[model samples]
Target: MSLCQPRPAESGYGSETSLRRHGSMLSLTSAASALSSTSTSSFKKGHRLREKLAEMETFRDILCRQVDTLQKYFDSCADAVSKDEFQRDRVEDDDDDFPTSARPDGEYNHNNNGSKEKLFSPASPKGINGIDFKGEAITFKATTAGILSTLSHCIELMVKREDSWQKRLDKELEKRRKVEDAYKSAVDELKKKSHYGGPDYEEGPNSLINEEEFFDAVEAALDRQDKIEEQSEKVRKPRLTLASPSDAYSTIGTHRFANKVEETVQNHMAYSIQEVGGDANWYYGDLKLLKVYRREVEENGIVLDPLKATHAVKGVTGHEVCHYFWDTAVRLDWETTIENFHVVEKLSDNAIIVYQTHKRVWPASQRDVLYLSAIRMIPPRNENEPDTWLVCNFSVDHDDAPPTNRCVRAKINVAMICQTLVSPPEGDKEISRDNIMCKINYIANVNPGGWAPASVLRAVAKREYPKFLKRFTSYVQEKTAGKPILF
Candidate 1:
């Protein structure tokens, strides 16, 4: 019999048996085809899942979690660093306390060589990938000078991956990693994604089997801080007081001082005069007037205008006559303009008292300030001139330190100056631009104009404007160089 030939079931076997045998073979082939299709479907599904994961932003979420964990770790570690530095300083001090004192007996002898000092270096080792440092020593003053140096060094410590750490960085990193890994694992198991096709991690925080439990643990370990601030004095601030400023001056106060501010102002005035060799607040040229103390020098008085005399000690010009007459009366009468201050607290033999010095810059070099109080060539010769000196009481703000030891600062009043300078023509009232200029020009003494009015000064000094401008600029430059010089 041929193997390829179809067998007639009727020849030797029954037809039902042959049909059943063929049916069984066809069913087996169909099952094999179905199994192959099912395997292919499973393989395609797996490939698609792997591709999706590769493109997905799961790592971004991991990075943020890592950063948050890292931030907490850094904060904790910084506190540890501060405590460690303080302890180190204390240990160093303790070591120093041992015996580095002078020998008994008055002198260090010439023949003896000093004993060598034992050198000690407590160097701070790099912390964890060098992030957490373990009992590392560092320079206390040196480390704080730079802001970023410690941060850079600490970041490297994190990557050190050291197995043994008193406070391990990897342990913290590992915790962060577990958090990320667990999140990823949960995402893999979780099927529902948001409309944005990314996992809404916050919405499914409970997806993690132990998320709440982990969160509670971290919350328990968190750290924090608070501070109290001291208030300062301003215009809006209420009045304050001082009890005994003479004994001890205090920069800070708990409760407000009621009369302290007024006392300080009075003290400021008295102290300013006393500091720079001034006995009393009196202006003398024509005559002398004292407040608490009054003294007068009558000898070698300035002569008044004589009969038709050319270039008399007293000037003939109307303005000159006024000055000459004024000087003679004040000096001859040996009495103070202020009646209450007539008593002499102290008397000076010299007649040239209450003198004022002006700032004069040298022509050759602008920087060279030739602060001349006494005119070298003037008639009544001043003997108390220093080689290099500066004028005192020039700046508007008395707080600024003057350039030269010759200089002192003081505050003057504005109204006194205005009253002395501007004279009304019998009864004319308004202060015109010309009237203001005449008043300023004739004024004998300067009063306290705390900050000079730019408008008024400019208007008054308009004549000889060129000379005034140079003087003003030089004054400004010198003042600005010395202090904060706030406007």
Candidate 2:
């Protein structure tokens, strides 16, 4: 057969075998190509991994060198700080012998040698403790200096605080010493008085009347007078009018004396409204609505204990409360201790001079008082504040009422301050007693000219003050129930 001619047709089995062989050969070639490609890709991946591991090793060596350098630097810094502290402590311990004084500009001078030194020293070329200093060590020295400066300032502040507290402690100690001395003197006087068998040696009609006997007699007289007045009410006529201010017999030294009284009254008002020390300083009443406080005060070397009482009463106005307190006509009616009371002079419509004698308390002489009573309406300090009423009674010297031996003349600085609070009525309704409340601050500073047992006076004050406030408020409520609103 010619080479260019078509091949002869083979048998069917031969042709099938040839086709299977050809198919097997093609499958082998494709699989070989796939294998070669996979090997090349894996080789490249392994090379890249090796390169990354080499880079990691180099970075670790660099980190190790840096850590080593930092550790050495910190170790050196710790050594330097220890040496500096040791040197500073040594210098301080020897300060007494060396005698250094700090200058105003924060430098120190040796008093012994007249040489100056800086408070904070600069870093030197030759480092501290025989070690040489470089760049970072110089920075460390500067930081150490700043820390030391702050510590010095803190020490100075502590010294100043200690001095201030010492002064306050000294003042408190002085006050306590004075109080102790006064108490000792009082005790000695009381002992002598007790040894002399008490103050019953005096001969007078008032001296014979003890507290109980005097009260019994006064009550009987008051009851008889009340009955007589009730029977004579229809036929009684108003008494003659007293001398007018224009026809005054003797004015009450109004220019200077009035000013003094006004000042005393203002002081009393301020003290009455001030807050007491604490619950321990107050003696509470049975009703728990009244608070009473007392403290011994020394004036002109004579000890005087003053009593202060505070209470809030319902169903009353401040004006009514203050009016009843300032009025002399009703003084004996409510003041059960006063045996008799009369007005000596009327300075003005709101001011009067009165003299009153109190019932004798056993073992104590009869007491009387001459005082100027003045009342004023204080306007509200602010728009939101309610009106205030103040009645002040302070002792005064008058020519008509001179001191007598039968009764010891007492000094009184008393003030009654009241504030009215009105709760608004619903829907423009007029305010009534139900909406009114009165706050009362009563202060009584009584100084008996003669000596009386401090314990007796304090006991009487503690027992009688709460009763007086309660009764006084109740009387005002009853008297003003039918009267028009005073506001």
How far in Å is the alpha carbon of 93 misplaced in model 2? 99
Candidate 1 RMSD to the correct structure: 42.4
Model-by-model lDDT, in order?
Answer: 0.26, 0.62
My TM-score estimates for the predictions, one after another, are: 0.12, 0.49
Error of 1 at 296 (Å): 99
For candidate 1, which ten residues in a row score worst on lDDT?
306-315
lDDT of 1 by residue, 327-355 (tens): 32232122111112111111111111122
Among these predicted structures, which one has the highest lDDT? 2
Best by TM-score: 2
